[model samples]
Target chain A: MVVKVYGPDYGSTKGVLLCLIEKEVEFETVHVDGFKGEHKQPEYLKMQPFGLFPVVQDGDYVLYESRAILRYFAEKYKNQGTDLLGKTVEDRGLVEQWLDVEAHNFTPPIYSLVKIYFASVLEGVPADPKAIKENEEKIEKYLDIYEKRLSQTKYLAGDFFSLADLNHLPFTSYLMNEMEKGFMVRERKHVSAWWDDISSRPSWKKVLQDYKNPYDVLKEMNLVN
Target chain B: MVVKVYGPDYGSTKGVLLCLIEKEVEFETVHVDGFKGEHKQPEYLKMQPFGLFPVVQDGDYVLYESRAILRYFAEKYKNQGTDLLGKTVEDRGLVEQWLDVEAHNFTPPIYSLVKIYFASVLEGVPADPKAIKENEEKIEKYLDIYEKRLSQTKYLAGDFFSLADLNHLPFTSYLMNEMEKGFMVRERKHVSAWWDDISSRPSWKKVLQDYKNPYDVLKEMNLVN
Candidate 1:
């Protein structure tokens, strides 16, 4: 049976969808509205106890958390597609290391800032400069580390463009292009090159072309009313 | 070759050490002091560019991030001892989902509170109440989900013990015993029972017996001047 995914096609679930596309896996998606509190509904909670989106139901098996879903596809479909998890134990360890870094260190600040920035853009409220400055500083320090790492290795885990690199695409893309924080990645030469290289991939571009912002996501579902 | 782990035996490295012991794997420890800014020095940075401890070296491969280290050891020594990842693809997906929960959702608030609480205990200044309250609230919400899950399944991932449960031990132990947040876990019936079951495990007991706090780690290294 094809995997059934419940979440917006272009929001938090975008990464999972991108992974499925990258792996060329067959999956069906049901858009769950985030703006209208649909994700918090009891039914959604039954599928995902945390009431978070992008939960994948593979026949009887269900899994939530976007990155975990990515790992699932990468591992389950290892013989097919990109082989995102890496080959050797060393490569796998390094891959897991960067995936951890991406999850713990990289995404938090960027995601926090993006949430506020997106809401501000939608609701027409000025973002807290103090908060923005703090989060940006956090991101700057991380990007510096990324700059150093990318200078040494072509991708985060190593020469291979693995899930560690692909895991970053959606969030970082939104941060730079949507939130206008391009300088965060672009200013650092290695990071800039890394971003350009990864974002330009056919899979990510496909995600971009099919992607919708939160506002559209809400409106399309008639969730605003 | 046996893995060589460089980091404080306690502090953040405690998780990796516990995983190693749980796996019944032999490893040589070289404790690195964080207080003296040794982790920031050039030599340590060569192994871990992030300059964070517990970087584990298995022959030519070196990996850092405590959770990543846990994953590495679990995968590498699967045949040696307790299997930490999971048995099947479904189980693995669920495991990764919970691990992601530990990383992105569960740890952030508890870690933030721990840092503040630790600072308060070490220095003469008081911890920030508002900040603590905010973090505690975040944790409380997550524990409600944990309580629900524990009611359904014996452990976070499932009935079987995996790294999902072990990954939680270190910070949570500090939060409950050290920071007097037992109520956070103990107040919730299922979560409390779950905590009790996991914390009393022989592996965790060994971790507690062998672990040292950062202050002790510094002193042992003669890093405090």
Candidate 2:
């Protein structure tokens, strides 16, 4: 049976799609329209109580949380495609460490920036300049740490492109392109190179081509500026 | 060689200690006092650039981030003690899913509350009732989800106690006892029972007896409250 992933094509869902593609897993996407608040409906709530994006259904088993889904496919398909978890126990440790770093440190500040930046455009709420500046500084501090780590190793979790690197694709893509914060990546030599390396993977390229971000769709429709 | 865990016996460090005890891993503590700004010092930052609690050094390998360390020990000692990653791929997926849930959804609001609740007591900074109310409400929402989850399974991941449950020990302990927010857990039937089960573990008991939280230490010192 093919893996069924439910949610939109953008955000963390893109990360899930990218992992499935890399793992060479047979899967189909079921769109949950966030704009219509379909995820908050009772049926969707049964699968994901929090009504979040990108819940995966594989046979009798069901799972939510994109990072968890990424780990699942990576472990399940360990031999088939890109080696995500890494080779040694130590390597896996670093992967888990960096994954936490991404979740706790990197994601929060950048995500805050994303919400603040997009709220003005999407919701007509004026973005707070102070909050934006604070978030940007936090992002820069974290990127500095990333720069140091990337200098020592080719990727965040060592030389391999594990889930640690893959997890950054969705938001960092926004930071680099859509959010016009590319300089945040470009300013740091090692982080810049690392971003280029991970973002250019064929799997991510396929996800980019196949899954149009709803925000971009809105842009094309002239509904969002 | 015994693992060398640096940083104080508080917050995340307690979680690491609990995992080590559960796994029956020999480990020694090396304190980096956060109260004295020791964690931010150069020597400590070399091991953990973010200057967070609980940096573990086993032999030549150095690892930080408490949850990552919990995972490292759990995977390394999979056969020795509690099966934290879960028995199968699907179980492991649920374990990872809830772990992310704890890190992403649960930790943020509760941590914010902790800071707000303690700031006035420890630093003589007036607490913001509005922020406290918002965080408490957010935490209650997440706990409702946990109540639903625990009703179906013995633990957050499944029937067995996994990292998902263990990871909640530290902050939840703070919430239940130190912060005097036990009502939050006690009000939810399944969540209350789950908390009682996990918090009563001998390993956690040992951690509690062995390591004292810095804030509590300060209180003893007539430094805080």
Candidate 3:
């Protein structure tokens, strides 16, 4: 059975779709437009109790949590060109390690920035400059680790392009856009180089082109440029 | 090779130890007393760049994240006892689901309480009543979901005792003591009942007995009594 993903365009769900594309796996995308509160609606919430976007249904199997979904897809579709999860026990552990870093260290600051600068506009809350500054500092501290690691390795998971790099594609994309407007990635040369490589991938390009702006309602609120 | 875990008697490391016990895995615990800043030492930092406790070294394999450690141990020691990760694809997905819920939903409020009520005393910061109350309300909202789920299933993974249930043990123990003082868990019937069952487990009992002082430290902070 084909996998069905419920997600918004240009969101974290885009990461999952990009993975599927890179794996060349056929799947169906069910766009749950966030502007309509579709994700929070009864149907979507029934599928994902937390009402988060990027819920995947593969046959009778249902899974959320983008990292887990990526891991699941990678393992299930191992015939795909890349063994992104890991080829060995140590590699798997390292992949898991980087994924944790992505979840615990990277995403928080990225989301913090998004919440203060972007989400406020999307959710109609006033943006807080103090929060944004705090978040920027936090992002810089976290990026230091990535910068150090990427300098030694070609990808997040050493020399190979693994799910760890793929998993971080969306956040890097968002971060790059933020950096162009004076965010800190450029100063972190290794991170900047890594981001440039992943952002330039064909799969990521497709994701960028295909993602629908579910938060367009925020435009009505003068949130997006 | 005997698995070696570098962890303190208290904190989230207790959950790791509990998982080891539940799996009937033979492991040696290297207690890094947090009071001395052992976790931040260069050697420990090499094992866990985050400077967090609960770093496991099984032979040449080393892993740091507590949840990831639990998954690794569960997968490696699958025949010892419980199938905590899950027996099937869907089961594993649900295991990941609850784990994420615990991490994303449950942990924030718990951490907030720890920061305001517990960590403040340890760090010599003044306790903020406003933050404590805010965190308490957040925990209450998230516990309602756990209440509903536990009312239906004997365990978090439905009918089987899984790592999901084991994962919550330490946090719940801390919360229960907190509830006894000012933090509230008694009002939620199902959550209270679920707590009673899991806390009564032998593995949890062993963890509580082993981490006596930190438990006292939590009580001294009035986070638990």
Greater TM-score among 1 and 2 belongs to: 2
lDDT value, residue B165 of candidate 3: 80
- Per-residue CA lDDT of model 2 for B1-225, tens digit only, reads 899999898887888988988899999999888878999999999999998888999999999989899889999999998778888989999999999899889988878877776676677899888898888898999999999888999999999999988889989988898878999999999999999899999999988888897567778878767
TM-score per candidate, chains pooled: 0.91, 0.97, 0.89
Model 3 TM: 0.89
List ranges where model 2 is wrong by over 4 Å: B223-225
A33-96 per-residue lDDT for model 3 (tens digits): 7767888888887787678878998877788887778877787777775678667656776777
Q: Write the per-residue lDDT of candidate 1 for residues A1-225, one digit (tens) a residue.
A: 998889876656888988898899988888787767898998999888777778998888889998888888898999998889888767888898898888778888888887776677567678899998988898899899999999999999999989899888877877887677898887899999999899998988887887676656546556453
Question: Candidate 2: what lDDT?
Answer: 0.90
Ten residues in a row with the worst lDDT in model 2 chain A? A113-122
DockQ of each: 0.71, 0.90, 0.48
| Residue-wise C-alpha lDDT for candidate 2, range A1-225, written one tens digit per residue | 999999988988998999999999999999898878999999999999999998999998999999999999999999998999999889999999998898888888878887876677678899998999999899999999999989999999988899999989998998888878999899999999998899889999999998888677678769777
- TM-score (chain A only) of candidate 1: 0.91
Q: Look at candidate 1 and tell me the lDDT of residue B62.
A: 78
Candidate with better DockQ, 2 vs 3: 2
Deviation in angstroms for A182 in model 1?
Answer: 2.6
